[model samples]
Target: MCVEEQWLTPQGIVIGTLLGIVLHVRFSPDDQQVAVCAGNKIYMLSAKNEAILAELDGHLAPVTAAEFCTWEKSMLISVSEDRTFKARKL
Candidate 1:
């Protein structure tokens, strides 16, 4: 599950997972957002406040790796066991 606690205290707001177990996570250059690769889908979330922003769906198998592009601030690259590599715009 990708649930995130809102506060430091034990009693805090929690956000639930979107899909399968997260295998890898990468943060954008600005650090305002993060990308998570779980199962066969990739999810973008707010780094300041862990909230889902967008979902990327295409990979047929579990996503293995994910990284933010240095040259392109708006692009994210991911590789999967499906023998495929994809570049998506953030």
Candidate 2:
């Protein structure tokens, strides 16, 4: 899901939301990227432009949490409502 989207100020026009209810969104350890867990998928986005760079889909159910490895920045870890865990190497 390469959402080529934009974000506005609090008083500006509202933009569309991501694919589904966002469970989690956070910056990477190096502060160069973003990870989002939503609707059984994990989205890796560019921190500078808020563009989706990658979409990870493996869980059978909605993903609950996603986080970047503090030590290894290339890895993205997530847990799903399906009772599973995954580690994606970026």
Candidate 3:
């Protein structure tokens, strides 16, 4: 994976469980934050340590996509199978 080659070293590997099916992943404009859409939730993670920074629980069904705003680093947009979308400011 690109994340393994670029972010992880020879001894590092991604391992764990998320909320559910991971539909999309996106990075902030500054590349300091990561947004992951899994199931019906959006998980905000730190790029440095890959730690959970926040969990956005707004969608009712599975999330389809997620992205961060280029001009505003605090803005996050998401679409879900619940037939709705949300734009939140972090």
Candidate 4:
């Protein structure tokens, strides 16, 4: 979902548990979703309920960072210890 500008204050924070080491967590541009970088995969999670939406697995090594593109609300980028940068649209 592409949101032009986010003006509303988030109602609450999302809290949950995840397996393995979590490298990074990035909120979607619209603040309705979350992308978690853990180990070799990116976990797409729901911001409202903290539920696992999907798992993005492509890197062969541990992921170092993940973020949502500010300009492209549906785009996500992840970097890995294997020296590769991946971009995906959610």
* Per-model tally of clashing residue pairs: 0, 0, 0, 0
Model 3 accuracy (lDDT, Cα):
0.82
Best by lDDT: 4
Clashing pairs in 4: none
Across residues 28-50, which tens digit of lDDT does each residue of candidate 1 receive?
88988878888998888887665
Q: Model 4 Cα displacement at 87 (Å)? A: 0.7
* TM-scores, each model vs. reference: 0.77, 0.77, 0.78, 0.78
Candidate 4 residue 89 Cα shift, in angstroms, is 1.1
For model 3, how does the per-residue alpha-carbon lDDT over 13-45 read when each residue is reduced to its tens digit? 342244577888887888887888888888888
lDDT of each: 0.82, 0.78, 0.82, 0.84
For 2-85, candidate 2 gives per-residue lDDT tens digits of 344332334342222456888888788777777777798887777776477888999999988888887888888899999999
| Top TM-score model | 4
Error of 3 at 17 (Å): 4.4
